[model samples]
Target: MMLDRVLRIVAAALIVGGTLTAHKSSAQDGAKIAAGEVVYNTYCATCHGDGLVSSGQTFDLRRLEAGARSRFENSVLGGKGQMPPWKGVLTSEEIDQLWHYIRDNAYQK
Candidate 1:
């Protein structure tokens, strides 16, 4: 009976640890998202629209799905359609932050 109780406690601890690790891995850090938001407002909002809302004049950033990260990076860095390349204008870190901000506002999320 003592062994059974110990096993149950150990199992519970493992489950809780697994749950915490999963949550930490799945959720984007809030600080990174906030920093991304600042970068977006300063550099992207002019065309992407404020708060990621588009006026239908440009691509709606919120429409991008979770799997669109690579496309996002490519487009921003190389430019797409009428958008200008931001490769020289923004650092990779700033671009990553912008991605986080856009991800946070994504419709699928």
Candidate 2:
């Protein structure tokens, strides 16, 4: 029936749309993470170490889990322990990119 055919076409279109959206999101995340890496190397490598690898003297960035975004942002913005605050130095978008970079290289992920 024409109704059945139309329903099948609608379902397929929905599935394809969802897939494309997910793919686009993933690609955007990858781009953000790459940009974040550049920012990290410029600003954080001195203390955080290269490629998120710490030398035991500093906190290992890779140890941060996925659910730690809020904590991460808070610490970076307000400063944590000995770490200096980056609130004035970095924009929110830059911070978000840094988070994506960190999350991408997380040990657990």
Candidate 3:
């Protein structure tokens, strides 16, 4: 009887812990997305369009696939076509935040 009771309690605790961890992770993602939006508006909105909506002149960021992180990073850092290199202009953290924001709005996801 006692073993069963202890097991139940442990299982409940594990479930609660997992729930809390997921909530924390979601909150962190939200913050990063928000920060990334700010960065995008400041630097990329002119060419990329507001909210990742392309004006047909530049690439549509929303078309980026879920696995396109490396492609996005390379393009941003090395510059693609008319785009200038942002290697020294944007920080790594900003890049990561931008990725998170873009992924959150990607067509695949």
Taken over the whole model, the C-alpha lDDT of each candidate is 0.88, 0.94, 0.93
lDDT per residue as tens, model 3, 1-109: 9999999999999999999999999999999999999999989999999899997988989898888889899999999999999999999999989988988898889
Candidate 2 on 55-104: residue-level lDDT in tens?
Answer: 89998999999999899999999998999999999999999999999989
Best TM-score goes to which candidate?
A: 3
TM-score, cand. 3: 0.97
| Least accurate 10 contiguous residues by lDDT in model 1 | 23-32
Native-vs-model 2 lDDT?
0.94
TM-score against truth, every candidate: 0.81, 0.92, 0.97
Root-mean-square deviation of every model = 2.1, 1.2, 0.7
Off by more than 4 A, model 3 = none
lDDT pick, better of 1 and 2 = 2
